[model samples]
Target chain A: MNPRLSLNQATIKHADLATALSLTAEAGITSIGLWREPVAEVGLGRAATMVSDSGLRVSSLCRGGFFTASDPAERARALDQNRRAIDEIATLAEAGAPGSAPVLVLVAGGLPAGDRDLASARARAAEAVGDLAADAAGAGVVLAVEPMHPIYAADRGVVSTLREALDLVCDLPAKVAGVVVDTFHVWWDPTLPAQISRAGAEGRIASYQVGDWITPFPGDALLSRGLMGDGHVDFASITRLVLDAGYTGDVEVEIFNQELWDADPAQVVARVVKAFDETVAGQL
Target chain B: MNPRLSLNQATIKHADLATALSLTAEAGITSIGLWREPVAEVGLGRAATMVSDSGLRVSSLCRGGFFTASDPAERARALDQNRRAIDEIATLAEAGAPGSAPVLVLVAGGLPAGDRDLASARARAAEAVGDLAADAAGAGVVLAVEPMHPIYAADRGVVSTLREALDLVCDLPAKVAGVVVDTFHVWWDPTLPAQISRAGAEGRIASYQVGDWITPFPGDALLSRGLMGDGHVDFASITRLVLDAGYTGDVEVEIFNQELWDADPAQVVARVVKAFDETVAGQL
Candidate 1:
């Protein structure tokens, strides 16, 4: 299980809970990564019970971090939602119980509407996430701050690099805050090798996800990710870097191409499993 | 003229040389940047005469850098092309003569066909640009390394940040080499402020191009730029940084939007001049 595969729900966003669970189980993947939307649709309590019954390990919850709003009310609302998300992770589904905390992944949001102060947006994100420390710790959840690719810096997340993300959570406890190293987001970074090593040294690598970099990325850019072997990411090299840095965690595949979404859930799972075995797991 | 304005030819791309010349002159802009393609189309000799006759100082030449082919022959060919481009900058066209050199802005080419080693591609670009130093210096030309946005890291340019570009030309003499600070590209960089300061301190701010960062960028991403006031870039701060850093050069506006391209040439010139006055020149 050197490269234990965990399928992030975003990869198969169109699938329902029962189908997704069955597909992952059938594919022989014992671990999973859930999205809040899908979980809510299935009713959080029932979904938690089902995952517990099926003995599926939820590696992490998909989101929680849009604290860069200018209005006070909006800012407070985002924090409240994140707190709820943290609470959800606490009692959320996991391998053997209905109340095991999954790592909570945090996507630092973009600049507030009509505001161009990137520094302030980032500052607010750091403060808000810091504020959530008490609730996350109380719920026994780890918060992983995800620094998206720089292209997303304008409309999505201001935390555009590992160093920036680490700086944001510099004061937080290691167990309560960390960073997600997704190949899609960070593969282009020249400083990635050194940063990954530093993250490992600091015990800040909460998740090590893999995705490939493809060309002529779609207009949206968000859906530009391809299957591991289908695109150009150097999986062997990146995986080695992570492993060398002491990251012994689930290697999640989170492809977002429209073609993958249109495929039959079982076929998608089989393809993902095979891809993991060859492109990612093979590296391990 | 602390922040003297220069209209890059690309900003009024649809205009022919005659109209482009007349438009810039009519708009009261004494400086203009030219592209090799348009210059070639207008007959280099004639184009040089028109610009010189119109009393427009050529602040810079659009490009010269694609030396990252895996094929030795192709790479050699790119180098030869760049050498020719350097010659073009030195002799093709200018303010008052056919042989006066302007600052040549160079964009590092992306990966060679079927190559995934971005580091190698960047290394190749640096070596190529370094090789051009003697020719650039001999021709009284300066090579400005323009680091495009990270989104262009795949198909267009591998040099994605000012810091990386500076690293590439670190060994070259300041007069023969420098960096291009385009707001559309480096504005998203978290490390931009410090890098710009360093570029200025090192006399590496060869050209400071201004354009706004608009959202829902076009599918091409290349044409996503808008007029100064039409987008979200903070021109005031960026302009201040440039002035503080001892760069008393022309601030060029290089917008590439479909609508702007479709507008009347004179109207486009008027709009650009107005935008510069309001969004950029006003800062001075």
Candidate 2:
């Protein structure tokens, strides 16, 4: 197994923190990217201790951003939630082995319900990142904005491209905010290579996620991510671009397929290891 | 009803060419964008006659371009088919009432089965458009490249943004090639305003299509488009940009919702008119 391969917990959606860590270690992978829900279930302090016990690097914390709300109270609650997430990321990263990235992956939420003003929603999302900049910087945590595919533009994310995500954090220092280059979301961008290069040059590439875009999307658009080699994404080429762009971080395998989530966790980890080696691990 | 309003035949998918024309005329829509499949169902000449008899203008032809095939035989067939479609567009435009536009909307097909070379596939799609440029120009028709949303990037269109589509025809005259600004596909783009401005400035805005991007995409992503004012698209703002950028062509309402398709055609047309009037037509 590749040392830089990180098993993002979402790949084994039902696995508890202890189980996820055990699976990664047993599979010989050295890194793990965790989600807030599972972490919260275990309690943040216990989750941090679990990470220390596993002796694996925490590539990133799954998420912390849905800042498109127009209601002041909702907006304030979102900000407060993000600040807590930033603190969680700081604790988790500290508990992990050296080289762990203190990165909080931020997914800009979709438009506010019944709101058709996309520009204003996008502006609010950017402003929210700005609002969180100080908290992130103060905590030595990086807010990595993950721009989702345009398909989720209405309900999941308004930041639909790496360019837009990077634009939102341009004013902040790289240590305060950056971007995640998730293949599932950005594989179709014509400006991908240029933007990846720009991200590397600007030192804003805080995380590198690898996932395949499968065809015949499932009934739920959110579960459309597939195993690496089973879909149409050319991992070798995209991995090459990422390496060329100087992103030498852990290549996190983050798939969100219903079938995979239902499969045996150990078997899924084994398959992910093989797929990563065959498709993207070699480039890293 | 807005004189510039055009009913794209796909909005009434089950309607044959005759019924589609009658519906458009009865609904007070001054024009109709056609689909070749329905036109082929009645033979081109007779379909043209029906369109002419209806006394409505032809805004553009629905499609012609699946040119991402890797096989030489497939590529030739795609180009030949596009050429025929170009001739059909010319004939239909000539038969329609005055102000008819000889335009063929081209959907750049997805990657060939099992192939993941997006850059190569995109290049081929663009080259195919170049191959058809002469035919389109000769027929005095414009081949309008319709950039579908990135959600369709793998299986429907490799050209996923207005910027990429415009770049493909940058060297050609607007008369030979242009772009279709379908709001459903591009409403999520942060760069939409700038791209529309660029399209108008370059005289490449061949068609301005209106559709809505609704949430919880139905099981089939293809049928995800909702009617105008029924989803998150801010049509009034987009229409203002198009008008401000100087695109005076038909504002064609093209939707693909299952419910809308199953609804009474007259009622659907009425709803479209009301939606367009409330959401987009006023800006025109």
Candidate 3:
């Protein structure tokens, strides 16, 4: 198994924190990317302790952004939640093994219901990120803004290109805010190579997530992501692009497929390790 | 009905050429974009007579691309078929009412099966278009390259952005090789306004197609498009951008929704005209 391969907890969504950590460690994986819900379920302190005890690195926190709210009260609550998430990142980064990145992966929310103004929705997202930039900087956490595929622009994400994500964070200090280049969302972008290089030059590549886009597309658009090598994504090529872009962090295998979530997590971790080695590790 | 509005035949997929023509004309639409399959079914000569008799302008032909074939014989076959399509465009343009456009809409095919080399496949598509440019020039027909949404990059179109499509044809004469600016394919693009302007400045805006991107994305990804007002697309904004870019051509409403397909053609035409008027024609 590749030492740099991290099993993102979403791959085994049903598993508790303890089981997720054990499953990952048992498979000889040295790192994990965690979701806030599971960590909250175990209590952040207890989760930090388990991560420290397992001697595994926390690659990044799964998410912290959904910042496109138009309502003032809802916006305040979201900001408060993000600040808490920042503190959790600080705690987890302290407890985890050395080399764990204090990174919070952000998925900017989509258009508000019945709202047709995409420009304003995107502006709200950027402003929200600006609102939280100071908190992230104070906590020494990087807010990694992820660009989702355009298919999700209506209900999941408005930022749909690396160029756009990079543009949103360019004004901020790279150490405080960056971008996540997930293959499932961006593998089809023609300008990906150039934009990856630009992100590297700007020093804003916060995390790298790996997943494949399968054909005969699944019924659920969100669960359409497949395990690496099981779909059309050329992992090695994208992995090479990331390496060339100077990203040295753990590569998280973050598939959202229902089949993988339903299967034994231990087996899933094992398969992930093999897939990462076969398809991505060689490039690294 | 809006004088600039044209009904694209695929929106009424079950309708034969005659039925599509009559339905479009009965709805007071003065123009129609035709699909080659239906035109071929009636035989080009007979189809031309029917279009001429209907007194409706031919905005453009449905398609003349699929040019990403890796096999040498397959590539040659696709080029030959495109040449025929160009000839058909000329004949149809001559047969239709004044202001008919001799334009062939091009959908660059996806990556070859079991092939993950997107860059090479895209290069092949561009090369094929380059090969067809002279034939198009000879026929006085514009090959309108369309950039599909990135979701279809693996199975439908490797060209996934208007910028890339424009780049592919930038070196060629704009009159010989242009682009189709479809709202559904490009509404999510942040750079759409600028690209549309560039296409217009370069005299490459051969056709404009309008369709909305509905969410709760359907099971069949290909059939997910909706009528103009039924989804997230702000057609007025896009239509304004196209008009501001100096486009005076017909706006073809090209939807692929199964619900619309299953409806009566006359009713579908009525709904399409209403959607276009309420959502798009106002801008025009």
Candidate 4:
């Protein structure tokens, strides 16, 4: 019943699937989030079995929705690709055995290439989410629609708020559609506490990812993410809010800073775990 | 009538007040936005007289509200400082002479140092805004609460949306409190069109600033702005929206790119004016 700690693969981008798995297991973590590229590299079947046998859970899958392409042919290709992603999550969840409902984190793709129509892009993404409902439900995977920061709205995902993400799938059951609570993305949201409470009330809180907002953000701003206490995000309060929203789920510490990535994987893991313990889990 | 082109001073950061004034006037621009620093550098009286004699309208006074300090003494100091900003804007309004209702754009400052409570910061800002109601009304200056991009919510300004800004000043008369619609800051908002319409309907459209959203943003991020057509912002539509909302005011071009700053002041003015003509005003 101790707070579940899940390591997001991107946090250790250099680590291969084998090394990542072994490291997470060695760290005494029961859950490890999987990224599509790494899982595919290891072969989904092999990856699933490795995770299964290792007794570590696949807490979530790092994406399967980019339904914003404006071209008809490209849109069809995107849907087909998403179907395959859903199937992979389903298979991984099945292999992980009892109680493994691996959430498929869907990063609503940004505006279609060279297109400036955000409304249309968002509409297309919403429609695509509905189209995948049957496939996702059939696979017993929840579509965890994630809202990236507005900084990414132009060329990244159109879904950029918890309310917007939830509204996209309000009709679907919690197992079919939910929202990912990534503190790094949603921490600046003024209405987040209310939205988190609403998300909990609606039973659509899919996954919780945590990273702090550091200052003097990197030139490549995505890598500006910091370990919990290393930046401005009030983890204890947000975690409390998430917990209050009935999210007794895996607390994924997903830092993507260059210094962290450059550090020895073991050292990075130890440092991150210690930070999480002090900043998030220990405080709770 | 000619879509009143006004150059924001930050768009030509390297230029002295006199150079910026002459270049803008020579470019046939009828109005110019002023930042407090450059105006102060030239002596406010001389600067005001120069702007008045040059026959150029003062479009807006670039900022006057940072009422989010956590300390009681700091909060009182901030209020007093903003009163001076209001007084300065009033003097500029007076000096701008015929056909000028110069707006005082208020950037609600970000959270206080070492403060993690955004809700309190926002509340404090809201309160500070109300405190300025009397002074602003007396000065004949509109306190335009400009909502910054959410990325700045942590340390720059807590007002991150037009709706939030409007809510803070909705009860105040349009002449007392208004909102600045900088396309760069609010273009990503899904409810922008509606919000723009609302701002116009409420007569709270204080100012309209234009800048495009170029990618591979600069290290500072603020200077990543580009000319109208150089980025993904759909200025024609946004301009149309603002026009529809009854904003018959100067359309301020406010690019903050380092390259733009390094360019010859006159040349940058010409290029921006050309870009605006083609991408925004021409299309509109």
Candidate 5:
């Protein structure tokens, strides 16, 4: 089978939900990764139907977890929002018809206020995931925990390494937990190969996202992602490792850059597709 | 004995070499850490004599390594520069009355040609250090490998963990190889406690530096370090671990902030002294 390629909506931020959907369809890409805010803006039910009619597969939902908050009320709010997101994902999967269940990706939140205690933060994140897993399982949505880079340790995700993510998931049964290995986050890790093998062996490989790293221009951590072949990451080796890890899943191109967003949406998709092809060819 | 505190010259960057010396002496900090460019600006021999006459101990020279270049000519240049740094360190030690040797801190350079091949870069660094170790021993100066943060793995030092630093140093004899544990680079590491014990057991603990983690800033990779208590690092716990590891040396404050650099040099020194006192009292 030809390699499955999915376009994460962030890569085409220049387009609205309708525009992104239409552009993606025109580009002949069969799968997409959707973000929550855009879906909500278009109304989840309407958005689900739009995607359904488009005949595109939903590879994974953008995210669902900000489990690290100091206030109990805030934590409860995050869980409630996540449960609602899971329900929406279940609806979308059903609307998309049989044999099309998109993975629900979880981005475990960073440290709580006045809390530099990483150990406790990690414990809290794992506990939150355990609570969310039951609902996710019932909905037939595979929960994929994406371990973000260490730079995001303070404000994004506490699960910075695949080993750490696997350890967290080990508490739950294999069917309940899996991990998403994003090249942008795990490329710099020294323990990538071993962790990838472990994830695959345990049946915990759920999603595999790709993006390159670009040093942010100071105070812009959230959006400085690089285009493929634009940075120093070894995508060829990483893709080989993921494929070896038994990850026969969609290769999602997820970039968050203002430069790409400002360009034409079709141009961005075409460029990424070309890069993805080159990456597979070992020319990257 | 009261814990002796030292000021790394980078913390008071605005002050000229002579001014920093006078202010540091007046602040009751009898130990100092000097960087190469500043030493070069004010002739190395003259700077050494000035430091000696001020009746202050030179705790460690700031650096002497950038061994990640792949080109033969560039590699030779790096080694030659390191030799000169070693010679200057020897001159400083000799110029000071007998029995006052300073440790030369080494930051093994990052990837060569901007390439991200960590294992190869590490091998190159180890080979270069083996050559420099003999010169360091001959000059009565100990070479201290300072493992930078993992965030710097792509562009700075590949030796991001204390365990990795110790392993790199193991290539040399015990007398010639040692490691510097800086709080800023290592406090977040999960294996820090165990690594500290290992370093102590192997008699490789060379210098102990302190700084905090300021958010949302890159701070010039080598510079832009935070002041203690102003960031997230647990200074007291790390210091205790270092002490437990048989490190009975001066705790040096090394901040590299634009705000602090613009302040009065005397004010910066005073603030550091206060922070050091508070950190020790709070941590102990």
Candidate 6:
């Protein structure tokens, strides 16, 4: 099969879900990753139908899991919300072609209430994931845990390394746990290549996302992502490592650049495709 | 030694060198870390005389290195500049009290222009250090290589890991090379404790700096550092690790906040001292 190309809807967050889907399809990208707000905005039924009609593959749902809260009520609410997100992903999967289910990507929450006890936050995140995994397995959706960068260890996600993420996954049932390898988050990790290999050997490789690294930007919390090749990230090397890790997943371009968002969506898509092509060529 | 406290001059970049010295001494900080630009601005000889008159220990010189340039001319220029910095440091040492010379903190340069070979840049940095080490040793000063954050791997310093920095030191002449453990650059590293121990075992730890991590602000470069306790960094744990690593040096409070810079210098020094006390209390 041809190398699948997935466009994360966040690449065009300014656009509505329909516009993002239509634009992605027009660009000949077969797969897409959706954010929850757009799914809710368009209504899950309509969103699912639109995705089905557009002939676009739902590569993975954007996220589910903000489990680092200190309050028990907040934790329960997060789990409930995750269950709904999983249900929505399942709906999209069933509505799609005969045998494919969209993967649900989970961003385990950072320190709840901005508390700095990273150890406790990590434990809570792991516990939340185990709970979410059962529901995800029942929904027939693979849950991909995306460990964020360390700079976000305070208020975003406690799991900062692929090794840490894999450890968390090990606690959950294999049928419900996998890992998402995003270059933007894990590129600087010295142990990345080894972790990628370990993930592949353990059958935990779920999604491979791509973006570059730009400095002096906002905190590591979500923004500050560079367009592929625009910054210092060595994309080709990371892509090669992930591919070698037995990850045959779509190469999703998930940039969160304010500058790119300001530009024409078509131009942005075209530039990304070109960069992806060059990155692959350079790697091979 | 009373756990000598030094004010890294960048903490008061807004104030002139004389004002910074006066404020630091008045605040009971017995040592000061001087930056090259400020020394240059006030004339190296004058800056040295001022410190001597104030009876302040020059803890570690602010910087010297941008060695990883793609151009040969630029690299040579940097080397020449480092030699001059060494000469200036020698002057500071001669003017300092009887037995001590200020440690020259080396910031190994970032990636060369249009060249993303981090490994190569690191090699060049090591070579530059070797060249400067001879002079530094003869001048009765120690050359301390500071491994910056990985966020600066592209533009500021290629030495991102303490292990990497220690490895580079192995190539230098014995007793001439060491490592600077800066909390702001290394607090996020999972390998920090082990590296610090290794640095101590090898007698290669030269300096230990502290700063916090705050987000939503631009912290890409060496600047943009948060004040101690204001961010998520676990200073107590790190300080213990450093102490365990055999480092009895001053726990310098090095904050790079514009807000603090705008405030009264006396207030800033008082806050730093308070933070230090709290940090030490927690650690003990």
Candidate with top DockQ is 2
What's the ranking of the predictions by TM-score, best on top?
A: 3, 2, 4, 1, 5, 6
Ranking by DockQ: 2, 3, 4, 1, 5, 6
lDDT, candidate 3, B91-210, per-residue tens? 999999999999999999998889999999999999999999899999899999999998899998999999999999999998899999998999999898899999999998999999
Docking class of 5: acceptable
- Worst-scoring 10-residue span by lDDT in model 4 chain A: A93-102
RMSD of 4: 1.6
Residue-level lDDT of model 6, residues A118-148, one tens digit each, is 6778889888888887788888888889988
Off by more than 4 A, model 6: A1-3, A97-101, A171-175, A215-221, A281-284, B1-3, B97-101, B170-174, B218-223, B281-284
**True-vs-predicted CA distance for residue B32, candidate 3, Å:** 0.7
Better of 1 and 5 by TM-score: 1
Candidate 2 — which pairs collide?
none
**CAPRI class assigned to model 6:** acceptable
The deviation in Å at residue B232 for candidate 6 is 2.2
Candidate 3, residue A213: the lDDT equals 94
lDDT at B282, model 1: 70
Q: Model 3, A1-284: lDDT tens per residue?
A: 78788889999999999999999988889999999999999899899999999899999997888889899998899889899999998889888899899999999898888888888889999999999999999999999999999999999999999999999999999999999999999999999999999999999999999999999889899999998998899988898889998999999999999999999888888888888888999998
Candidate 5 lDDT, tens digit per residue, B1-284? 12468788999987888898899889887777778888898898788889788787777787888888989999999999988888887777565533344678888887766575667888898898998888878876788899887667777777877988898898687677799999888876667899999999998887888988766655354554677777667677788888888887777788778888888899988888888887754543
lDDT of 6 by residue, B83-175 (tens): 888888778866755434457888887666666566677788888888787787877667889988767777788888798889889877546
Please, what are the lDDT tens digits per residue for candidate 4 over residues A1-284? 23388888889989988888888888887777888898899899899888888787778888788889989998899899888999888888777636566688898887765678888888999999999999988888898999888888877678888888988889888879999999989888877999999999999999999998877566786787888877778888899999899987788878888998998898888877888888788545
- Candidate 5 scores a chain A TM-score of 0.94
Candidate 2 per-residue lDDT over residues A67-87, each given as its tens digit: 899999999999999999999
Error of 6 at A194 (Å): 3.0
Which window of 10 residues has the lowest lDDT sum in candidate 6 chain A?
Answer: A93-102
lDDT of 4 at B128: 92
